[model samples]
Target: MAISGVSIFVVGIALLVSVPLSQQNEEVHLKFSYSGETGPDKWGSLKPEFSTCSTGKLQSPVNIVTKDVIYNPKLQPLNRDYRTSNSTLINHGYSIGLFYGSDKVGVMIHDGKNYTLKQVHWHSPSEHTINGIRYPLELHQVHIADDGSISVVGVLYNYGAPDLLLLQIKSKLDELAKEACGEDEIAKIPIGHMGTKYLRRGAFKYYRYVGSLTTPPCTQNVTWTIIAKVREVSKEQIEALTAPLEGSCKSNSRPVQALYGRKIELYNAMPNKI
Candidate 1:
């Protein structure tokens, strides 16, 4: 089994979790994909608004080089306040997403700013690599601040035991994927309340940086926190997550972009232990 950088990307016909922030803007994605003419390289030319895809100085999904990382003693551990809340898993045509509705799922505090946890989405083959290693799956917990700035908590995963949360939602996920292809809807498939155990469990090293959404508009200034604790997920679980989406989403993950001299900061919840 590979170690180093990994986090939980949960899925199932059996437990918990599903899809990305980019899926939220179905309009923009309707014109883009992971390959071919509308691929990452041509995202900017697809539309006038997508110019940032080619022009932005600060982009996301950069490979995190450990040796080049600077430890920031001043950086604080991510303060997460989460819980089991009423949730729904939906298909976004190009992606599948697990979203919280009506109820407050919770929030996380970084640099004294509080962002509400909105939804959790998965990206296969992991987006942000560590030491040039890309894991099997990645989960991005999207949070939005009052001013609408986005902060994402990323979980990279390697194979292990099945996640219970995914096991609980497997049937609903399958049902939606089978019926919801090419539809843009929010939380229509209620899977009841889900736990926040994965987010709160254990102590791990996390990397912090300023970047953009991995998806289009390719919006910058998004804060990214990638937890270094790799979580367990089974192969069966992986298939359950991807069964719904079509096209670029089938193997959705943008190619790693250049760092452009951006500084990557490392934070350890248990100092000096990792």
Candidate 2:
């Protein structure tokens, strides 16, 4: 089943009011970064809660080699329910994120489980690579299950014509980029539409693996589905995404982690397959 765009907008508004501003403000000072003392390598040491960054064996952003992937006909096509919604643009210090309102909910169905969309964020010089080749940008749509498990659907962007969704938020991004850190006023954005465009039209082929969050806490048991087909975004869009992060960190991506013998399943579209 699919969700309507108007329903998504209403839910987003509900979520925004449910969360108090004070609580969100308090979380803005965690002090993590992409380089120097607070870099990825130092994440575990900076805070006790972030120890997983250095110690976790199942870390994410691994290099995906096509030759090493096992074809899985059983993997189901993603059932995405999304729509345009009001969103807030935040400069999280480490990366830029577009967050949905607290009451809003979008879901992705896979293997009989449902993961609700929470927010969308970007990383430059793409963290996950295809056969060791990194793209100009990467987009991550973060989702959560009722049990709080996380699943991130990743899309890599190559240089090309501008993306309509990116263009819609370009002005807000530029404004946020000017400030070192903080959030802009809430704006209505077609987030669900943006996500749908990528997930629905692309080659259904994707690489799946279990890994930890790319950020601190580095919590494990996260599911990742990275679309094999690349998407297009303009050079200007790439600049808008990365410019804000340039002053503090050389790059916003974690170096590709070791596969650690983890098996990667390539979900291929086959007739009469699940």
Candidate 3:
């Protein structure tokens, strides 16, 4: 669900991006761009493993038609038991990723399954849209279950007051941006005891759906949970997040994909429950 759209984002307020712990998963080394021959349109054919990118019935980064969203009472609040972990910040040429080094950082309990937290990443101009509007930034909290199933909790951000999460790592991002442009070495910052709570922005309400991985090898059956409330982020914060990827141009968002009969459900949390 990494960014790749055509329009300059318009935040009427509503998101996603995920850079995996391994560079291979983010496909950073892959020859895919937001446009041109190796762009999103050509992802499925770039390699045999990426065939799902073109053929998957339920591709991600779908526009959430709020009116059509079925309010599922059974849907539960997002339960993430994240902790402080020894983490590494890697500036993959295409994205900035925060990776957990421990056996597990934490887990989110959904449908009684514990999806272990893996990594978090950002995408500019947002990937998912709300009511046909796109936000300035999106943060993805990616997790996986014992059976290899995936669950991503997304938080969308708009231009406003600075995000504390970005504030903490701004300087590091600036340094990484220079390293990414240099091409001699990948910037790997060993930031100790980083916690994932910084990613928990927005309201308790969220929209849930079954979708594919936003990036290539576009795996299917991944669960997506997008926070309903939009968080505040300043333009400077957005700039810091995208700086490391300036070599590839500022736009990294993937355009919204066809819904293909997939159902989007909203989890309206009970008062004081979330």
Count of residue pairs whose backbone atoms collide, per candidate: 14, 4, 8
Q: Which 10 successive residues of model 2 have the least lDDT summed?
A: 7-16
The C-alpha stretches of model 3 lying farther than 4 A from their native spots are 1-29, 180-185, 201-203, 270-274
lDDT per residue (tens digit) for residues 1-274 in model 3: 1233222221110112233333323323345557777678888998796788899898889999998988888888777777778877775555677877645788898998998877788889899999999999988888877776788888888899999887877777776666633333356777777655776543478999999788776777889999988999999888887776644446778889999888999888663543
Q: Give the TM-score of each candidate.
A: 0.85, 0.82, 0.85
Candidate 2 stretches with Cα past 4 Å from truth are 1-28, 180-203, 270-274
Kindly indicate the candidate among 2 and 3 with the higher TM-score.
Answer: 3
Clashes of 1: 14
Estimate, for each residue in 1-274, the C-alpha lDDT of model 2 and write its tens digit.
1122221011121122123433432232245667788778898897787788888889988999888898887898988877655666655445667777665446888879987777777888899999999999888888876766678889998999997768877777777666633322222223332333443455477899998788766777789999988989998887887776535553788888888899999887863542
Best by lDDT: 3
TM-score (C-alpha, index-matched) for candidate 3: 0.85
State in Å the error of residue 62, model 2. Answer: 0.1
